[model samples]
Target chain A: MQGMSPIVKNMTRLVAGFIVLFGVYIVLYGHMTPGGGFAGGVILAGGLALVVLAFGEEFARKALTHEAAKTADSIGAMLFLLIALLGYAGGVFFTNLLPVGEVGKLFSAGIIAPCNIAIGIKVGAGLFGVFVALAVFRRAGAGSSTGMIEG
Target chain B: MDPVLLLLLVLLGFMLAGSLIAVETRDLLSSVICVGAVGFGTSLVFLLLGAPDLALTQVVVEILVLVVLVRVVITRRDETHATSRATLPVGLVLLALGVMAAIVFGTLATGEDEGLTMRPFGDPLLNEQAEASVMAPAGEKAPEGAPARMPKSAGGAFLAHGLSESQGSRGTGAANYVMGILLDYRAYDTLGEATVVFVAVLGVYAVLRKVGRSRHAGNESDR
Candidate 1:
């Protein structure tokens, strides 16, 4: 699909970065703030969706391919599972194996921060992949025989 | 009425109006937008209720739902007007609403006589009591046959003992109680939820991949 006017494209270029950065901040400061991994990840996906909406399908595909999203999703999930499994060394599943430092600090929450990061990545990538899949499928079914399916 | 309650009532009114408009709208796009407005209103209610996490989640979910619904509406060119259904479904809905109202009123009529205590909204007395109990350590162990002396409210107990050094156990180290509960206290549950989301995304990918492949094959066969 062709993109929108230059105005929309330029605005998307200007705004998408700030949205993504805000999402990252929410995810990273999840332990101290109201927004957590899930909320932040959805925000991140919204940012990506904004880009897709502004620039249309082709540009989004080039920036974040379906394969890349799938890989990120898998990696995020695996990383979360790996973190959980690592707790086995502490003689229990999902044990807080890391040292608990002073509270309110960024690195103070043992395992919770890392867990949030993992969940954030997983949720963001997974939602983006779903959007891409749905968008591509709709495009393909709409008389575009040579759309994302072959790619 | 209290100012917060008054504001909540106004928001609820808007939400109800939005829902009604969404149901009655003939234009699909307008209907989707109306539903999104309802969702946004509900999220605002959540925020006003002091549940920022829930508000954030609701807002994000609403956005995603809006995106998907808009996409679906855009793709399907047919059926511009929504068909009006029979009155039976509406009757059933009203009946369900009546039943829910009856249940709620009946429960409220029962009062706090059933070993339930009603506390003032946003009162910190329970927290203080829990803190006192934690500090005393005298009532930690009750007689085997006697009643338990723990705090009546579980949340206050969590706040008192879940994060700090208490009861000869090291509490969850996370400063944020919600994170502590989710990742440290009940990490397995979070893992399961993550797994569910993962499976859902994979299912979407698989379904789309199959459709794409079949369509491609059909095009090739035609050629």
Candidate 2:
């Protein structure tokens, strides 16, 4: 296939960058907007994928390491579970142990916002890790196919 | 049309288009994109339905599915495509369409009005509080320093309305009251669901890692 023209490539990268920024905005305004952790996380991942496609896979790998992704995923899940456990100790599971503050405010959602952040990290990293693992497996499969022919 | 209804219609349109694509596309990757579109539609619907909780869950699950599906498609990119007859597929499609149409029409005809106040969940507690009449016992009333008794309408205070007579506007403890209901009243069920999610994550991680490692080993052997 012919390589994309310079203009097209630049446009793609620019759009991807915009998407990533918009995702952040949605996530932060989750309570106010029609978006939240899951929506924003996927959008962020989409931007990352676009960058990889436009630039190169190496760029993405360098920006996001497998080890770091795994650690982030684990930590996110653990923090969420800990929050729930804390609620349990307080005689409620998933209870808002923290103050609720004023409704519709940034800090108003209490534990909900933190929970959303945890979910975002967990989902984004877990998804990225899955893709990485699959790519590695696919490469191995290709190598094996080639070997069979050689033998 | 009302803004809410208009939004709902838009979401429904997306859902329809996504389903059509998912069913019509022969390529697995294209089908996966269709599924993602369907997820986007559902998330929008959830947002309109005043259920942010469900919307968040849907978005996260959709990403997980998209990632796994894309990985599969890329790995199998070199595989050959197999074509099938269009006649049988068309016939099947017509039959499915007819069935869906009949079901939808029947359900709509029988369904209650959207504005219907009565529901299968029974009368609302907010409107029926006078009939239920939950009041705390005299001795149970807290001393000056103790936490205030929760109201009947407040979450988790289903058994005895601890502070029905009190005139304070839900007090400064509204958040605590709600939290108590969510955690204390429904702890067992919520915990069960959380445990299930936790286990699923572990399962996905384990299976994925094993798949990766095995493929790596196999590739080395082949080389």
In order, candidate lDDTs are 0.76, 0.56
Tens-digit lDDT track of model 2 for B1-223: 4567666766787899889889888778888899998997898787676656567658756765676677567545465365675566778989998997776555334235745323322122443242222333445543233234333344323434423322111221222333223333443554454456546656655654433344356568668
- By lDDT, the best candidate is 1
Residue lDDT tens for model 1, B57-131: 899979987997897677666686556776668789999889967754553343446355334233324433332
Error of 1 at B107 (Å): 9.8
Off by over 4 Å in 2: A1-21, A29-33, A140-142, A145-151, B1-21, B24-75, B79-101, B110-205, B208-223
Q: After superposition, how far is residue B88 of candidate 1 from its true place, in Å?
A: 2.6
Can you list the residue pairs that collide in candidate 2?
A93-B183
Span of ten consecutive residues with least summed lDDT in model 2 chain A: A142-151
Which residue runs of candidate 1 sit more than 4 Å off their true CA positions? A141-151, B89-151, B166-170, B210-212, B216-223
Query: Residue A72 CA error for candidate 1 (Å)?
Result: 0.4
- Chain B vs. true chain B: TM-score for each candidate? 0.68, 0.56
Error of 1 at A121 (Å): 0.7
